[model samples]
Target: MNAVGVDVGGTKIAAGVVSPEGEVLAAVRYPTPRSPDKLVETMVRAINEVGSGKDVAGVCLAVPGFVLAQKDTVVFSPNLPAIEGIPLKERVGPEVGFPLTIENDASAAAWGEFRFGSGSGVDDLVFLTLGTGIGGGVISHRALLRGAQGSGGELGHVTVHATGPRCACGNRGCLEALASGTAIGRRAREAAVENPGSALGRLAARRGLLGEDVTELAREGDGVALSVLEETGRWLGIGLAGFVNVFNPEVVAVGGGAMEAGDLILASARREIRLRARPPSRDLVEVKEATLGPESGVLGAAALARNTDGAYALGG
Candidate 1:
């Protein structure tokens, strides 16, 4: 049987027809609409477009927010605010006309990695997504861990420092505030302003840039740019060390745009994870980049549907 997975992101909505074996058979993408109703319409169109000629078993949506399991309402979403507290099942159920499931985007990605990507074969694992902001998912004993309120595994919000930068969650020193791509970019821009002679400054001068651009320059041997990445990686490691102590997962799978910097970022993170994490957890957990890349969200949502019977189960 086939399943339809939709990745409802801040900028775009992507849907794909996924087979039981995790292969994407068909895919469609569209800009996400602003309003809740229009967003649902856009998602439905994408689902129908990709699933038109395929035999679909169910539909799964991977959204970024605190999902109320029993109610299937998106309680809060920082990126897509208009849909917060909206009845997702009621809005999309009839339009899709099939069993539906909803999952947090990070959790969906973790499921994808656990089933078919880098974390495959690992019973306990953590999946960290380094996008504009940080997001994470935890899998323990071959099952996804959704906490008491279906809001577990929010590693991004984990406090990394007592007196650090403020976060969108209205907290100080969150992992996301310190090490996310946006954070890295903000720091890079500040560095460019401070040191005009540095390679990062020159690059920023030629074109107003951010973390990705700095990473590209570093790949070409830019010292200042490399330093920015190293700093971000170090902060990332600091956060992972805390995660290691708490979850003790078998593997830490890093995904998203930041990992594109390759060793420029991973080398620093690996060094810190080894230095700070407890020996047993450090030895038990392996830090690796995600193999599924951008497709993880949709693929994992498909995996959720393929494994479950279309019911949204928080912990099964």
Candidate 2:
């Protein structure tokens, strides 16, 4: 059967009709509206646009922040604050004319990897996306491990350093505060100040540095930028080491915009895993880049959806 998956992000909304085989049959994208009413309208329009004239059995929305699966409500989304407190199912189900469900974006992405991407061959998997913030999910024994409130698998909030920087979540020393793309930019600015004559320093003097700028500078062989990525990677590795011990996942797939740095970030993470993670688990885990890239959320949500006439369950 085919289903529609909608990745409702802070910046844009991506909706697609996907086949049972994980192929996207039709897709649409639109800039996300901030207002509650416009947001719902755009979402309905996107779903109808892709689902029109198709044999789509259901629809699933992949949204950010803490999601209460049973209630189909977004409790809090730091990036998309407008989505918070919205009764998604009640607002969207009738308009869409299909069985609808919701899942955390990162968890949905992990399911996408489990079914079609990096974790396809593994029974246990860990997925992380390092963007402006870090988002994560865990799949254990072929099941998505959503906590009681359906807000589990929040790997990014785990503290890697007790006395480190403050996170956007107001926590101290969270992995997101150290290893996310935003962290990279923050570190890059500090590095620029320390290395005034380096390429990174020059760029910072000309304009503000973003995470992508750091990667580009590193690609151009700038030592300061390279160091910044190295620092971020080590912090990521510190976090990964803990996950390796706890989840013992066969595959840890890293994705999102920051992954454009490729091996530059992962190589250090692997090294730290070896240094800090325990023997058997660390030896077995393979940390790799997620193959599904940006499409993972949509693909995973589509896979999780069910026909209107059939039963639908959140998580596994």
Candidate 3:
């Protein structure tokens, strides 16, 4: 039977039904509700929307926060404050209409990549999502490590600048604060406002600009946009350098909507990683773009469900 995968983000919940061979059959999305109860209701609704009345072997949820899959709990979620420490299984099971599993959103994406995407068959790999906020998942020794506290690859929270902007996690200089899509947009907007006559500013002055817009501008060779992306890549490189030094992953797969920058974002990240990391480790690692695109989270969530302890439970 197919499994249902739901990727719950700060703003939306994207759900899909996936075949055992990794094909997405049906998909749906809904705005995330604010209240904890409403969140569960929304998820149940989303699951049924995509599940299409099939008896799903399991339904997996990829949540943005610290997920304790063993206990089926969301320890903390800065974006979804109401659900912090909420017992997910206890709250979401009754209405979900099927067995369920929960996992960290980034970890889910990493698992998806490892199973069928860029890092497939790789024993050691790293996955980073450069979307609303930077997130990460890692695989070492051919196993997913969620750490003792189940937050192993929260690489975005790693400090990149000691006195940089404050992050949502209440910390200063985190990678998420520095290199995330939001960060790039923030920098782009600032540039557009400060120098409206420049190429990047002209594009921004026409309408509101997003991180993707900046990438588009960079692709067109807009000077300001290129500069902003280069800076963004620098931070990514600095943060990833630390990972390379530590994990020595064979491949680093970058994903998320913002990663659409393609060569603009990745090329810079690769260059910076090579410059900052040590010889063999830096030379050995290959940073590549994830092929799964937006569906990665949902697919990985399905993997989490199908491979949970009963499936492939990866509790550290």
Candidate 4:
């Protein structure tokens, strides 16, 4: 069966028609509007473009933030604020004119990977997305770990350090406050401002330092940039240490734009996990880059939509 998936991000909405085998048949990208209603319109527009005015078996929308227990509404999202408190599935389904499933973007990506990408065949696994903010999803024994409150894998909100940096989640020392792309960019920008002659600083002088810039600089052996990533890795490793202890997953797939740094981030995180996480389990889990790249969310969303059970269940 074919299904349509929409991944709603702060900057863009990615919509796609996906085959049962996880192939993306058709896709479209639309700019995200600032207004909540317009955002729904954009999502519907993308669906129409990818659906080609044809009805699919199901539709799914993947969004960031804490989704409500009902899954039809977004409880809160630090990244995409407009949709907060909005009943997305209810609002979108009428205009979309179909059954709809909604899930956290991170969960969607993890499900996509478990079903079709790097984590395939794995009974237990974790997925961490290092984007503007951190996003997380966990699968235990082949089931998506949706907690009683539907916020089980909100790894970004986990406090990695006491009295550490403040997170957008109204907390101090959240993992997202330390290891996210936003954190890396902040560190790099600070480094550039302090040391204008350095490689990272030179790039920052040209344009603002982005997480990618730090990664590229670190790759080129820029000491400051490398240090910043190493710190981030260590922070991630510490956070992963807790996840490893709790979930005991077979693998942890780290994805998102910042992962372009590849081994630079993984190596440090591995080191920290090894140092911090308990013995056997820490050694058991391997951290790898997510294979599906940017398409994981949409692919997973499509998979959710194609589910046999009416296809609109929240937190499925």
**Maximum-lDDT candidate:** 2
Encode model 4's per-residue lDDT on 119-186: one tens digit a residue.
99789999999988999999999888978877679999999888998899889999999999888888
Please provide, for model 3 over 1-316, each residue's C-alpha lDDT reduced to its tens digit, 9 standing for 90 to 100: 6788899989899999887778888999999999988988898899988876765788888888877766877787777786677788888877767778777989988988887799986899999998889889999987877988677789899999999998988999999998898899889999898889888888777888877778777888788899888889889989999999999999999888778887787777888888889978998999989989888898888877753337642211
Judging by lDDT, tell me the better candidate of 1 and 2.
Answer: 2
**Backbone clashes in model 4, listed as residue pairs:** none
Give the local distance difference test score of model 1: 0.85
lDDT by residue (tens digit), candidate 2, 1-316: 7889999998999999998888899999999999999999999999999999998788999998999978899988877889998999999999989899888998989999999899997899999999889999999999889999999998999999999999988889999999998899889999999998999999899998888899998999999999999888999999999999999999999999999999889989999999999989999999999999999999998888877666432223
lDDT of 1 by residue, 1-316 (tens): 7788888888889899888788899998998888988988898788878878778878888888778888888887877887788788888878876678878989998998998899988899999999888989999999899988677888899898889998877789989998888888888998898889988888778888866788888888878888889988998999998898889998899999888887788889889998999978888888889999989998888878632453432212
lDDT of 4 at 138: 96
Q: Kindly report which residue stretches of model 2 are placed more than 4 angstroms away from their true locations once superposed.
A: 309-316
Could you tell me every candidate's TM-score relative to the true structure?
A: 0.95, 0.96, 0.92, 0.94
In Å, residue 56's CA in model 2 sits off its true spot by 0.8
Query: Which candidate comes out best when scored by TM-score?
Result: 2
Instruction: In model 2, state the lDDT of residue 118.
Output: 92
lDDT of each: 0.85, 0.91, 0.84, 0.86
- Residue 251 CA error for candidate 3 (Å)? 0.8
Candidate 4 or 1, higher TM-score: 1
